[model samples]
Target: MDQRKYNIYFHTHTISGIIIAALLYVIFFAGSFAFFKDSISAWQKAETHAKIIHADYNYLIDSLSKTTNLQGRDFDFYLLNSRQGAYINMSASKDTTISKPAAIKSKSKRRGQGDGAYFLYFFANKQPTTYAEGYDMGEFLYRLHFLAPLNQIPIRLGAPFGYLLAGIVSFLFLFALITGLLLHWDKIKANFFLFRPWSKWKTVWTDMHTVLGVIGFPFQLIFAVTGVILITNFALTTPFSHFLYDGKQEQLFEDLQYNRTIEVPYSYTSLDKDFDLNAFVSKWEQQWQGSPISRIHIRNFKDQNMQVVLEAKPNPSQRFAGSGFVKQNIATGEVLASKSPVEDANYVDGVRSLIYHLHFGDFGGTALRLVFFVLGLMGCAVIISGIMIWLVARNKNNIPLYKRRFNFWASNVFLSACLAMLPVTAFTFIMLKVLPEINQAAIYRVYFYSWLILSIYLIALRNPSKVNLHTLLLSGIFCLFVPLVNGFTTGLWWWKTWSSEANGIFLIDTIFLLLGAASIMAFWKVRKQAKSFQVLLGK
Candidate 1:
């Protein structure tokens, strides 16, 4: 084999580097802060911010049931206790109603309320859930870290983009780590902290990138592979599931089957004539004595013989199943199915479920999630720094004008977004709570549009002036004051919530303050450096 055949990899390597570097920065920065999502959410909830009092699950449910006529209705209710965020949401819908049957009689079902119910249904039932053309806050930022506006493409196209980015980035990161190790092998002994201020600008940049890359290599590699596996499972595992299982993915779901019963056809009719919700909730409470039932789903809402699904409250450690569904026959009030294993599932299902939990940090506590979040941020940083190094190295040579311009524009625009986007997104989160008119979908759309528009504008602009640095500073300042904004707008603040178990609000406030302070410092540093450069050149 020709040795230069290795050069073929670099063609894609360069592209991956350009794409991933920009993407990873946004991923790292936003993701790092997202570690405190629960805490931040706690900071925004009015009732939750008052104290660490655990709501009486049983009392709350009974009270909610009394307040809302749940009998003979097609809907379910979920009450989360000690969840560290937001007020009580007693969701009632066809699948969420405990006294009704599922509306969708076929293989697929859609939720009319929170996404958590469908998530529980899929995980508990051990069936795959499909995604539509929308975005979650985390997923949106992650996609921007790579695809950005290219996400307007359909699922078929977007999934491949995810896989390709992951596959190529993993390889390039692996190579860069190996090559960097080899290149630095000589100086490894003497120059661990080698930073030569007297060296040329490019030299300093390369050294900063390479040295940090070397230190963070292990983190980079783990994040690269895990992130790929985590994000593009639809791409990577779907093909494998088809190939290995002959496209019968049901076998893979066998592990998740807990008291799954056969689906039987039933006639459709509204049975909202008469039923006692108070007594029904009483019976449910008696059955799941130790288990706190969080959600109630009424399947086949229009059908008289619909089944009611009462989901168990989540236990922090092993609460991977979004919620447990206990199906009951509406006519007879007899329990039909639940998420407990009636029969043992195969190893594949176990592995698959475990993988999902691992990727999402669902199986872990706050500490584990924090670790995952930090590692993710480090991965983003590695991508940013690595790309910066590549650019600096190339710029040192007599590169062509078009290539130079492209690199300059890509570097500045992408880096600025990556650096500034997190703070901007943080503001959006606060806006979600503060602005009553703003719903979840609206919050996400506005956030996405704002980021996209700003990034495009930055890319079009040729020069970075004081205005650019000021924008960065403003983004951070807004993020830092988000907690205060929440307090003023919604009467929820960190200090007010400190006495309660919702102290996650305090953590959120501190994190924002730290991140905002860091951003402000960085802004001033850049401005000072620009001034020094101008003075030296007599500009």
Candidate 2:
């Protein structure tokens, strides 16, 4: 093997590495929080127990009939009556003679304030493709951070760019892991927790990154490759589908366990005078005792041959079970199919589902998710420390003062943007309630542009050491106050959540505290260092 090629394999281009580092940091960090998107919603919208029990779809139909004309039309009633969560919501089409299903309402709001409007506003402007609507905000942000909304590049172009990044980063991360392990292989028994600050700064950062990278490399590799696989659907899956199946897309879809939900045509004139939703519920509940149906989807609502899908939340361990899915004929109320992962199936379908589970950290219980969360936070730390080490290495060399210091502090400003963006995102979510009509899409645009402007201004401002320290402190204070403001505005807090054990909110609050305190301490150290540098300059 060629030594130069090996170096090329091991060390990525500087610009690419930095961009990948920033993107990966965002994905890992936000994804860790995104893991608990549901919990955040529950906390933000605490539901008071309403006197009325969950009414059946019959009641829903009746309500729509009484409220407005829903006769002789197609619509999907998302029977939240079956779901465990406190709210019930429905989507239906009007009697405008259109056969298509229209979203009547996405979600029911909790009293006082609600986050549904926020989520709705966020997705309204983005206009997600047919496939992307099922996923939540965190996943959307993860994709956006990688693809970065490049209008000049097509999906094919941007998707390849994304995969190339992951492929390259996975290779480098693997290199760092292997080499660091070789360097510390023998000393693992003696120096597992060694942190020698007195040594050269490179040694310190190298040791820190190495240790964390080595410990977390397995997750990093799996997550990076899986994320790449998830994003690059065509690049990874298309070749096999083409070469093996000879261009039969349906065969490929079957092989990959992708179900094509097609609507059957039927007469709209002869329809049942009354539909019984309670009867359907009774049959489903009797069959599956413990599982709760979360959603009931009716397709081709105006057509008499419509199908109904009842999705249930199974046991946590049943995530991969194909049997978890159930479908029924709406008119006849007959069970059509139920499949389980344990049964014999194509090997590829199993792989695809497992890949999704692993990427989302949904395979394991709370323990595994917590482990994933910790590693994700450590990944963020690695990016910050790596950038710091780069500047430190340059400064310690026999270089000019202006060049060395300018580069060092300029990098710090970018770091500020990366670290501070989380609180800014949280604030934006809160603002959705405070100002519902502000057009969230425009707000997001302003948020990102403002961050860039702030970062540039910080880099150009004089006395950068003091300014950098102040920026860090400002970030720390903002993060610390997030939960307090949430409580004041929403009337929910971690302490009060003890009775219900809202682990999601608890996790967010705890992580915010830890990050805020660490940031404050880091800023204090920088402040001390700035004073010492000024004293030396005075002499």
Candidate 3:
């Protein structure tokens, strides 16, 4: 490329890098860990720490029926067997009769509302153990990736703003990735294996950034594109529904569901006390055979016009194929609408499923998730090093310190954000393990406050490099002690958990221990670099 074109590409890359570096770092860091959400959740919750054993569906149905009168009411039963242990979540709402259309609309609306009055029945021993509401550690970290940026905004605006910000950042990330490739097109092959750690700081950072970026290019692109699709879908759904669907959001939903429509109106009438849930289960089992039932949604329960929807477990081979639905008429035991299994899903349905699975890294199980996590951290490294290279280039070009004061401040904020993330996350884990009884709201408060306090302290220092070093040291200390803290508080020591039913907890503890050691090493390296720089400056 000519000088002018090269300069334009470089400028575009740098500008985009600076604009989204911090946000990208935050997203990648938190999201990488989200791959192990269920494991982390199990690790955090004492009730779910034991080895998981699948519960008998017959027993589950019978127990739920006896405990909670399952006739003519809105209720759901969700089954899962993962690192979090095999459990059934049963939820029921008070009886309310409405017209069929109204019931359908209400169901759609309630989808986004919180899961109400749910009980988790764990199948640890031969008998079932029940756990009510508790803090979900996995969900907290997962939400931080996409929702933390909007925490301070008002609820009405915050959600949209969060989705918009995620979408915009994803778009710019793709732009930056393309520009970076173009700028280095000629050197791409050579740079793929290049790493000059012993060279000048800027040169070293440039090489590291290039190598990591190229290595994780495919994963990064997948994440970026899927992220754009997911976030923008949520952000723009309302507007699109207004313009394209005649202001009916339900119509948009119908279009996405392959234009399938359920217009049957509910004719409300009291039902007999002997509602045959066993028959419903039997029909479902006959249809799906070996496939485990993941969720069961019953609308207008106990009423003659009740509708039951059963969702089968996701197929692992089909990345995008989620649970298939089988809707039934409760009054007659007749199948109303049966969506094809995910394995045989067609174009539209498959694409929708693929988007969700890819974005969430839910398809490949633990091995794939580990690959994603490592690549995600490398992506974080790419962003951080790209910013450092820019700052270093600015210093080398003799940019006036006064004129670049704002840039300097922004750089500090960026570094503060990047460096503080790990420490804040580690601290949150420690807090959750140590205070298992804490409320959900309070757990998040601890997370946001710890992060905010550290960030403010770093920014107040007015020295990005110094702040980075200090934060690294602090983060290292916090991380290094995480395993010990977990053991002390939970009494589920790593050595003891390995051979027990709590292997998930054991794995989590081991990861934390390794991370702590890495943090400490990073702290030492940063401190040495700082000392070397001070000597060079004759400080």
lDDT of 1: 0.53
Badly placed stretches (over 4 Å) of model 2 are 1-16, 46-192, 278-282, 289-297, 302-304, 311-313, 318-323, 340-349, 363-367, 394-414, 422-439, 442-446, 461-468, 500-503, 525-539
TM-scores of all predicted structures: 0.66, 0.72, 0.83
Cα lDDT of model 3 by residue, 1-539, tens digit:
89998998888888887998998898899899988877887778644345345445456557655544544346556655452333333333334432211121121222222323334544453344333233477767777687554755654442566666777888899989888888888998777798977777778788988888888888898998989887777565788988898888777977676333433344557655455665776667677755566666667666777777876755554434644678887668788878756555666666787787888776687778888888999998898888777766665336665545656667777988787888898888888877646655767788889999998888777665677678777777887677788778778788878767576677677777877788778778777764332101111
State in Å the error of residue 256, model 1.
Answer: 6.8
What lDDT does the true structure give each of the candidates?
Answer: 0.53, 0.55, 0.69
Q: What digit string (tens of lDDT, one per residue) describes model 1 on residues 427-501? A: 676676655554335656778777777666665554444335756677677777777776777665666656555
The alpha-carbon deviation from the true structure for residue 365 of candidate 2, after best TM-score superposition, in angstroms, is: 4.5
Summing lDDT over every window of 10 consecutive residues in candidate 2, give the lowest-scoring window.
115-124
Residue range with the least summed lDDT across 10 consecutive positions in model 1: 530-539
Candidates 1 and 3 compared by TM-score, better number: 3
